[model samples]
Target: MTSKRVFIYAGGEIDPISIKSIKQDDYIIGADRGALFLVDNGIKPHISVGDFDSVNAEEFARIQGFSDEILSCDAVNKDLTDTELAFDIAIEQQPTEIIMVGVSGSRLDHTLGNIHMLLRGLEQQISCFIWDRNNYITLTDSTHIVEDRGYTYASLLALSPEVTGINLEGFLYPLENATLKMGQSLGVSNRLVEAKGTIHIASGLLLVIQSKD
Candidate 1:
């Protein structure tokens, strides 16, 4: 069986054309101004979720006109960010992959928050990834494989204090049952030697960053 993918748009900046080629079989959700961003780019999100405070009346009205469903949250008294709310909704659908968009912007706090939100999906065994024009980030624990995407570089960083028993194969810089510390930069700027690559970890969380020039 094929896995289902969900594309979620947060209020961060994004280039719609980056994902313009994505097929119509996936689900789409917009958060706050993200909904306006989608509609402005002629991309119709299946539903929009978030507090209406971020977007102005004109943009909110515009979203309401075209979006299938608009879930408005209270701005002042809310526990979750718009993107988190969107993730909560996406989780309900039992998706296999969650592609987060418009989540990496100037706001450092929100960007970090969105990254940690992957843990929520992680617990549910959903393969959540953060994608932008130049970056692809995914969180992994234990063993994982990364195909040689024919890209420029791939990096692995420790999400927890330390990731032990780390192993890397088919990469420019390979590791063999090694341990990586959280603040270490040893796993940065790795290249692939073959068509596919593999990453294996025994404990702790790891963040894989695949990028191209």
Candidate 2:
């Protein structure tokens, strides 16, 4: 089956490159003030969702006018964050992959929470990642290939208590059947020397983060 990509934009510091990366057929969801950002950029969102607490009445009107559908909630009574709401809607679309942008910003709490959200897609066997101008983050439960996408560094961290039977190939610092434990910096600042690198893990969850300064 052909892959369906869903892009979710949250009310964080957005990368213009991410906005430009959207294709004609890719689905777009704007969360809260992200809706205003999309409409202001001349791209109408397929769906706009959130309590819209971050936007004023005029901005909210613009979002309503530009979005095909709006899922609104009470700002003071909602459980999930605006970004989570958008993520839920994206999952409902049964997308083969999901790319989340504008999810990382000055707010460390929200940024970390959004990073944990990748687990939701991982649990469903969907390819999911959080992308920003400076970082690309993904959680993996199995082996995978990583490409040199011009990022300065590739770091691997154990999301579970420990990731065992791990192997790293095509990287400047290769590993053989190693184990990575949570809170360890052993996998930090690794360089992908080849055109493509391999990350093979036997068990437990791992977070692969490609970042640049």
User: How many clashing residue pairs appear in each of the predictions shown?
Assistant: 0, 0
Local accuracy by lDDT, each model: 0.87, 0.92
What overall lDDT, based on C-alpha atoms, would model 2 receive against the true structure? 0.92
What's the CA RMSD of model 1 in angstroms?
1.7
What are the TM-scores, per candidate, against the unseen true structure?
A: 0.92, 0.97
lDDT of 1 by residue, 17-102 (tens): 65675568888899988888888888888999999788889889999998989899899899998998999999997999999998
- Residue-wise lDDT of candidate 2 within 1-213, one digit each (tens)? 788999999899788888877999999999998888899999889999999989999999999999999999999998999999999999998989999989999999999999999999998888998988899899998897888889999999999999999999999999999999999999999999999999999999999999999
Model 2 TM-score, all chains together: 0.97
Highest TM-score: which candidate?
2
